[model samples]
Target: MSLSAAVRLRPGPVDLTSVETDAAPGFEGRKADGEAALAAMGAELAELQERLFAEGQSGGRRSVLLVLQGMDTSGKGGTLRHTVGLVDPQGVRITSFKAPTEEERAHDFLWRIERALPLPGILGVFDRSHYEDVLIARVRSLAPPEEIERRYTAINELEQRLVDGGTTVVKCMLHISAAEQKERLLARLDDPTKYWKFNPGDIDERTQWPRYREAYEVALERTHTEAAPWHVVPADKKWFRNLAIGTLLLEALRGLDPQWPAPDFDIDEQRGRLLDEAPIA
Candidate 1:
């Protein structure tokens, strides 16, 4: 089965806690094997991204948007460094959402999201997304209960619209165990080089781990759709997380079947023109 089909959460209630954070769901290999697989995908991944980028510049309307959601130290950053790194930077547009500014808050929750969408042919990745309006808002009571409820429907509609507009939406929830998260947090504290990465607020967030898990369950259940289903990637092992996401992205790109656009101009004429032209130098 395709990785997309394998990791996709079915439309219904979900139990995030039930997923094994260290297990590689569809993959049968160990860490070394996973790393090797990811390495092998590098060339094709780069080629596809370049084709997709070229297609966009050639007036193709299709694009891709990868939505990655997870808790602290769930390897969102690592995905960027490893999985996403396989593709050319020119083809990718990344957005790391933070607490909204007053300007952003003044508008609807998705207002900023609309602006962050990847242009045609580009791959857009969101570290955290409008789901925050539902996840964090619900957990922290940052918005009215009814408002949070309304955002779920809005998110679904927006994703569907994006699909109709030729953007393939790939959503992945990096699932990490609480114990693993604690260890990762402690590792940061133990390393002087990683001290800057440490966040006291993350520990505060940990205090509400149960609430956050419940919030994620609700968000996944309510917003998961055929238009853009959520993939629960096992993230405790960095190698598996990178390999899975890389495979997922490669599959999505291949599904688009993006190809090099035929030259719009006459190749023979351009070649002759180039040969006849005098060098300015």
Candidate 2:
């Protein structure tokens, strides 16, 4: 299947013009066996993550940056929780960007993001990222129109720089419908345990869904590039979401072909020395 076709299968807020996927073999619509696909992909990701960990430990000079952006209650946190759990904790780092603090605001938009970039031999996941400058800033009217426009160019340049420097960036925008979001918010409100997840601001933002959608449309159009293309994952089905994201990540990691580093010395010689030093059993 083509990239466009694959995207059509998943649910997420997307600007089709911004989407560029070369023909790739995959399911285009909702897979009837999505649950099974997810389970299989989850297993594959687990195995690949181990390989990435080993390679990174061996001084492998590669890194991965997984960026997750979506509306409130779109399952970004839940996705991170399950997806990151499949990787070696020591080899992965997760950063959740909330409202900016005075310190964060002091720096340029990408400064906080740059500081969070994964070091060689690790995977870094940004819960919400630099995209906020476009998404939130545009919706909330936090910046001048000129400043907002400038950020789009600046962000594209920054991501391109990272890609050129050996960072493999997998950017995913979780697409959930407004109606679905409303349902999720209501679920959170009604469930006592999930009540903590509710915030009045969420409802306030819902009223501006169309505005935010337009903001995302522009954000995706301006920033999606060959170097760091965005993938819109269908988030309405949490299981399918996990599977799709996990599959994409596993594919990227496996494609890198990371392997364990060779031992520094002869294993036989080391074993012999240990045997000679030991007392009779």
Candidate 3:
């Protein structure tokens, strides 16, 4: 299965309960092979990123935006470290959205997101994004039901504007099972090194798992679009998750097919001038 077919959420009604969180659909490789495959993709991703950067330097208006959303322990950070980490830092812009501060809360929800958008010829990654308003806000009752419903339309419009402005948005939900989440959380609590990742609030959120699932289902169904579709990545297997997302990203960049911009000045003349200049000691 292609990564696109394996995990990209379809339009219309979506039932989160039916999707397998642990399925590694497209990959039949062993663990070591999977790791090696991911490594090879890293090189490809680097080359494509360089082309994208060059295109931007030459005034190209294309860019990519990767939006990641999932429950805690779904490996959003891991995806960044292992998958997106392949790209040049100078060519990528990463943002992690947290709770709205006093100032942020004063404006519309998308105000902060608008400010963080990647420039042309860049790859932008959002650890959590505008969907938070629908997912967390709906589940936690942070906003009214009527307002939450409105945000669904609001998000679509915002993403459409991004697409219109030459941004190709790729959204992924790192789907993981409740059992896997329990094991991961326990491992975190048991390991001294991972204490910082263990949060009491996570437990609080876990208790509302069903509600959050419903929220996710609604958000995916409402917001998944041709312009900015969502991919439901099975993330219980960390290696597979990394491989799958890496593949998706590679596909997106390949689709763009950015080429290295040609030099506007005469290359031969420049080379001759360089050679004729005084040699360094």
lDDT (C-alpha) at residue 231 in model 3: 95
Q: Write the per-residue lDDT of candidate 3 for residues 43-137, one digit (tens) a residue.
A: 89999988998998899999999999999999999999999998899999999999999999899888999999999999999999988999999
List candidate 2 segments past 4 Å from native.
Answer: 2-5, 8-32, 278-281
C-alpha RMSD by candidate, in order: 1.2, 4.2, 1.3
The lDDT per prediction is 0.92, 0.79, 0.92
What is the model-wide C-alpha lDDT for candidate 1? Answer: 0.92
State the weakest 10-residue window (summed lDDT) of model 1. Answer: 1-10
lDDT by residue (tens digit), candidate 1, 1-281: 65556788977889987888888878887889989999999999899989999999999999999999999999999999999988889889999999999999999999999999999999999999999899889999999999999999999999999999999999999999899999999999999999998989999999899999999999999988899888999899999889889988998899998999999899999999999999878
Error of 2 at 171 (Å): 0.5
Model 3 scores what on Cα lDDT? 0.92
Q: For candidate 2, which ten residues in a row score worst on lDDT?
A: 16-25
